[model samples]
Target: MMGSVAQLWRHPIKSHGREALEAVTLSVGQCMPLDRHWAVTHEASRFDGTGWVSCQNFMIGARTPGLAGLWARVDEEARRVTLTHRDLGELTFAPDDPAEAARFLDWIAPLCPENRARPSAVVSVQGRGMTDSDFPSISVMNLSSHRAVAQKLGRDIEPERWRGNIWLDGLGPWEEFEWIGKTIRIGSASLHVRKRITRCLHTAANPITGKRDTATLDALEVGWGHCDFGVYCEVIDGGDIRLGDKSEVL
Candidate 1:
């Protein structure tokens, strides 16, 4: 069965929030443009903006699930990010500015878990998306798979937990894994499925409340015996891929 695009998301600031896009232009050898464009570095982090560092070097939802409650809007043309939360209201600034970074740190201090280290600043690397994979990746998730997971949990599972770059519909649960090492066409772009995305504690966080209210990992482990939910693909051919676009395994 052919899957069609259902949603697309980009996280301009890692772990802090998400932004939805109606359409996106995928480029060869890169993830969704402006996705993971910046990350919050902690005081204990050694990431120097030189190359990709382990996710542990940055503030992430796995460590502080409450970060999920934060929402962000990115103005690429202006290089600004607007962060909003139920408690914090809204904050707008350019991530690279030291003053802005300092302000962001202040706004999130209370939200930071006591066990984790303190946030220092927001930083970025040019041309590269700070992805879980060392290689640039676009995450694809099946809506049906989400439904299956929801069924396992006996409740509705918000798609935001996956933090995927693209979401598709009409495929069987976890069927995208079968396309590994194969090509897939989405709109005018093509992607080569490479790896299955391992589930993490981040999925346990509620996007609305940013609390660890769900047992996503436990459900996946009990139902599937493994914690995997999505597929990672490298863009092979670059073009526009929009919401409701056609996706076909090749």
Candidate 2:
């Protein structure tokens, strides 16, 4: 066993908020259920929600760091999400409803910078999640790697800053990078590690404060000569993955 699953997270709305899960059912050729199921497009975005589009087309944390502070709870059956933030309190709404979408835009307006493009609409494509990778992918992170970064920075770093889907413990620092081009089994699911997930400005923001408090990118570069924190994997076999499940290279 390479490690055990330590944490699982999902962003119901792309770059908007994060939700914690104890277990999730993975499906072949698909992202985690309801992960990035909806994205808020900006005024300058050309995405009409017809299909998968690049992350740059949406209002994201890299643009507005305050968005990092939002916490989310999802109701998969109702297709509804309740987002909470220190500043905004809470909002419960269905992303697919036009009225709720409009309300969400209003609720989130304070978090967005006035200088940047404002969020225009909430959009989603049928059967597709808005992952950063072109292909549907799940982000896997190593707890040891996270600690390495924190040690370099001389501060405790929150894993949420990376916005990873699954986090594993018991791996060596930077060991996950070697998993590329390999298949890994977590619980009953098998996933093919495709590529390293390069770091972005979004990771510099503190998930609790929603403010830039650390030079995460600089630390990664200065220490390791690269600014990558995790690996992107595509599910090859579908099954249930839960916290504490054994993870191993296949």
Candidate 3:
């Protein structure tokens, strides 16, 4: 039973940072602005036709814990994106500006040692690296499921570990499971509740400081039998979703 949306978050750069918004309007055939639109990649790796590899396979949950702390704010009018961090000052760039990508490469290259030399890299199936998953640009999850998993683990699991594009509140733990294969209306956006999200080692990694926290996994194994935590969904009717949007199950 979907109840109400509790929170909405977006990560502009994959594995680097997240931007929490009070509300956002989405159009078809496009992802939320700055949501995984860019990523740093290595030519030596695959996920390209070269082979099966991805950013999550490397430093994502492994080396840089601070990567989780990156924050972004979008300037919708200016068509610009600003990334900020505690150690790094605010960097503002237009999403489509060629110079912006160059600046991004320069700014972030040294922050993580892996991209130090070849930091200007791009991941284009036609050009550099790979794009994000599926035609469904947005990802949604149920909060009740989160709490259920937390209870099962006997400890609190931070929402960041799931990295969902949206977090819905006011649901019972595992109540979302009932909505599977159903359409749900969240604010102005309608989504088809799809499947349960399975856990990866990334769940064991803290999204805040980026350190690997095995407690979530340990709890899951001892209790839930697996690290499964939340539900995954696709946006059907795109529109604005906010912190307190009604997430009614249909």
Candidate 4:
């Protein structure tokens, strides 16, 4: 039987930054620790007033080459975040400061010229108007499935391209699909495999360089007959998930 926890990932800011973890603990149905806990929204926006914005609206991609260089770090204990770009040093924010949200919006505006909203109108994912495109939460990737696509693409694909919250390394190729409708154990925690994650334009964007190259998606379609590259799971039993934790398909 395939076993072992292959990878762990968390996105501190929704659609803006990602962090890889050597270990993590999660609560039942909680989002991968701090993953997508924060998000950036348009200048003029209200979370519930407007529908959830699609990631395609803003993210490091063909539209914003500079976003690739954006690196963000969160000090959860301090309730603060720091974002860094090549030309700029570090810009910090207090998660609670009412003005902090607006500051973040201004920071992203110049870089995202495609957005017509004024620079000062920034909003957070937790703010009134923000929500992920679909699903209440997101997490993980199957390493074998990721590799299969790379093999078919005839290129080395970076995990950033898929932007999965967790990247599992030990499972069989396309094995995660089989995990659907089942519960798997990671450390003491258990997660129920919900369904497959279908591919989108984000897959075409190079996760590292944030360049638009559809080769990855093309490979998936021609080789696998589908664009899916990962699976989604909802936490069942909660516990610490560390690197190399045993994974048992139950």
Clashing pairs in 3: 6-169, 65-209, 65-210, 123-128, 123-129, 124-128, 124-129
Q: Model 3 scores what on Cα lDDT?
A: 0.64
TM-score of candidate 3 relative to the true fold: 0.77
- Model 1 residue 195 CA deviation in Å: 0.3
Query: Model 2: per-residue lDDT, tens digit, 1-250?
Result: 3799999999999998999999999999999999998999999999975789899999999999999999999988998999999989999999999999999999999999989999999999898799999999999999999999999999898999999999999999999999999999999999999999987999999898899989999999999999898999999999999999999998
Ranking by lDDT: 2, 1, 4, 3
| Backbone clashes in model 4, listed as residue pairs | 43-121, 46-129, 47-128, 47-129, 47-130, 48-129, 140-166
Each candidate's root-mean-square deviation in Å?
0.8, 0.7, 4.1, 3.3
- Worst-scoring 10-residue span by lDDT in model 1: 121-130
lDDT of 4 by residue, 46-139 (tens): 4442445665443433345445545667787897878776555568887457688667766766666465543333334442222243644545
Comparing 1 with 4 on TM-score, the higher-scoring candidate is 1
Stretches of candidate 3 off by over 4 Å are 28-30, 45-59, 62-64, 110-132, 152-157
Residue 124 local lDDT, model 1: 83
lDDT of 3 by residue, 90-176 (tens): 788764677776787677655564543244453333222222354444667777777776777677878877777778777776676
Q: Lowest-scoring 10 consecutive residues by lDDT in candidate 2?
A: 46-55
Across 99-214, the per-residue lDDT of candidate 1 in tens digits comes to 88898899988889988898988888878888888888899999998999999999997999999999999888888989999999998999999999998899999998888999
Candidate with more favorable, higher lDDT: 1 or 3: 1
Q: Which residue runs of candidate 1 sit more than 4 Å off their true CA positions? A: none
Model 4 lDDT, full chain set: 0.66
Clashes of each: 0, 0, 7, 7
